[model samples]
Target: MTRPWEILTAATVAGSGLLAGVFFAFSAFVMSGLRRLPEQDGSAAMRSLNVTAQRPPLMIALFGVSVLCVVVIVRAIAGWPRPGAVWLLAGAIVTLVGAVGVTAAINVPLNNRLDAGTVLWSQFLAAWEPANHARTILCLLGCALLSVGTIRWH
Candidate 1:
């Protein structure tokens, strides 16, 4: 009796929540721990992390959720005026723009600069942490919206 859209919406909610938690971890303690280290050590550790993050698990989670957001957006638009369409659309947009977009536009570039040894660790932290916080908030917001939308859908 579960419809495809229902499944998709549920998955999106879960995915958003997962990403939020990941971002929150970084904002909450990972970055803090890094900051405690000497500048060169911190920078080196972060660079290593950046390389590891490009691997499949995190990449799939981030990009796979992104792909789902796109689908959810299309579904929300096409199914407009339905019970939870607006909430679903809002959730997808928030996640796509706030989380994924911010990561692509801001965080990755900062990481690249850090990796290349082009930017100081302090400078990277100054910029990256705030952006990470923003994405964390956005992902949480998206998850909340999607959860409400899913409940309303039923």
Candidate 2:
């Protein structure tokens, strides 16, 4: 009895969860460990990390998942009688804006500044970590919502 919307909603839940785990790793361990490194090493590491993170595969996941979230929202709305449609829509929008959008709008610009030597370590962390944390929470929230929605009426 699994329908197209069911499959798509399940995929959205998985995608959101996977991406959230990545961000959670950064906020929880990677950045803190980077802070413990020597100033020069830390700065160099961050720069390198940012560059490497933009690899095609990772970029695809980061962006592709966001796009899928939008598709899920659209589908959810179009077939409004689906039990968890509203939750799916809310989760998609939240993840799109709070996680993907924040990363693109805020974190990317801050990374650019760090790349250009316009900001120092303390400045970089202060600005970057908070936004990263926010995205992590949002992604996790979205994942939870989607998970619940996926199972609620299935």
Candidate 3:
């Protein structure tokens, strides 16, 4: 039977690959597509991209990576470990959790409001940008830490 750590490592690697390849890439791809849309096609794609970009599909994926990163870090440190290992784990946790909060609390709320049609799309996005940026920063940092974990992991 596979060990629990092996299961977690598999999940983490899977999440890492998905977030890196699919979730984040989907948003980027959509935005790139939006940019390439004919000017007359107007704001539908842009609006959709903004809302789609704010969701936390990547958080679940990154959570798996965080688990694996911790496991690998523990393995690497079996003999001797640097202080940064703890910092890396802690930071990833904070960043990932914060990304979730930023999405659920701020971004999702705004997306709901936008979807409700109470606010104009441009106005909604104007409000959405800051929350979106915060979540993006948190996720990006999580990705960076996870990347470090991937490279440093043995």
Candidate 4:
């Protein structure tokens, strides 16, 4: 048997990398898209960029958190006796549950409830500022901790 914790640690590192690539990478993509939106005509590019801004980050956070949970669960299953993992796992849980889960449960539904089309994006940004910021900070911190764990080993 490969043993569960080892599998989990490997998976978490890989999953974190993938999440970083997809979500954190979009910060630049979104910035570029925002920068170009004014110069470029209103077109598919705007829509694509807006969708990316609205989504991939959240999706990535959710995926990363879910994987973190999996890592812990695998540890439990494999009977890995390391106690230090609890810190990294707990940090991941707080960030994921508090940041990603709450945003999806609350803010997203609010966005969906609004009448379709003709939304003031500025207004949306303003309304979501606090929540969005919270999610961003928490997830980034969690990712950092996971990175440390990846390097440190138990």
Candidate 5:
């Protein structure tokens, strides 16, 4: 039978991986596709996207993963014998600070500016894409760390 920590660690890894994939999709295709459109169209599309992205599924993935990471940290610390606790904790921190923090600080604000028609497409994409890339990297790193933690623990 699987232990509780094992299950929690699995959740952490899976959630982080899911978020990383989402970020990667934005960087790989979504942004690229937006780039091909006229400036007005692209900005309008992105503004719409910002609103649409606040829906349940994406919200769950973005916020839920961070919550999962916290829970994993608690579980890992409580069971101090776990060899991978440190890595799990590190993963949690990375996701919280990099993915969530950056999103809240950089992307959301940029989106708001775009929605208000205060930002140009070049400016929006320039700032937004690089920050998103940072988010992608962090989420991927968190996934990798959590996977390692899971393996070491099990």
Candidate 6:
């Protein structure tokens, strides 16, 4: 029978992977597609996306994974010296600080500025795309770490 920690580990891996894919889409094509549009159209479309992104599905995925990361950190600390503990802890921290932290600190503010018309599309794209790329890398890294940890778990 599977334990609670096993379930949590699996969920965290899945959540990080899901977030990685989402960010990858943005980094790979969404931002590029927006950039290809006329400035006003791109800005307006991005503003609409910013508003739409605040809805439940993404909010849950993002914030929920953050919460899960916290729990995983605690578990990793408690289970220190265990085979997978270090990897798990590293994964949780990287995802929390690298992915979610960057989103909260950099991306969201840029999105807000664009939505509020305080920033132009070109300016927003210049900053937001780079940050999105960073978060994408972090999410993929976290997912990889978590997968390794899960595999090492006995």
Ranking of predictions according to lDDT: 1, 6, 5, 2, 3, 4
lDDT of 1 by residue, 60-84 (tens): 9899899999998998788787788
Better of 3 and 5 by lDDT: 5
Model 6 weakest lDDT span, ten residues long: 1-10
Clashes of each: 0, 0, 0, 0, 0, 0
TM-score of each: 0.96, 0.93, 0.53, 0.57, 0.93, 0.96
- The TM-score between candidate 3 and the true structure equals 0.53
**Please, what are the lDDT tens digits per residue for candidate 4 over residues 7-111?**
665565555445444444434455345545553332344445446656766566556557665665455334435544554565456555545575687556545
Which regions in candidate 4 have their CA more than 4 angstroms from the true location? 1-3, 26-32, 35-61, 64-81, 110-115, 128-133, 149-153
Candidate 5, residue 16: lDDT: 88
Residue-wise C-alpha lDDT for candidate 2, range 33-145, written one tens digit per residue: 99999987988999999999999877887888888898988877886787877888888887787667999899999999999999998999999999999999999999988
* Candidate achieving the largest lDDT: 1
Between prediction 2 and prediction 4, which has the larger TM-score?
Answer: 2
What are the runs in model 2 whose C-alpha is more than 4 Å off? none
lDDT of 5 by residue, 1-154 (tens): 1677667678878888888889899999999999999998988898888889999999998888888888877866876587877877778888777669999999999999898888889999999999999999999998988787777765
lDDT of all predictions:
0.89, 0.85, 0.53, 0.52, 0.86, 0.88
Q: After superposition, how far is residue 117 of candidate 5 from its true place, in Å?
A: 1.5
Q: Candidate 6 lDDT (Cα, whole model)?
A: 0.88
Error of 6 at 143 (Å): 0.5
Encode model 3's per-residue lDDT on 1-154: one tens digit a residue: 1377445544544454454454355345543464466643424655565565546764445455556655655653552364345444644564545445666787667667666666665565566555655555555665566555544444
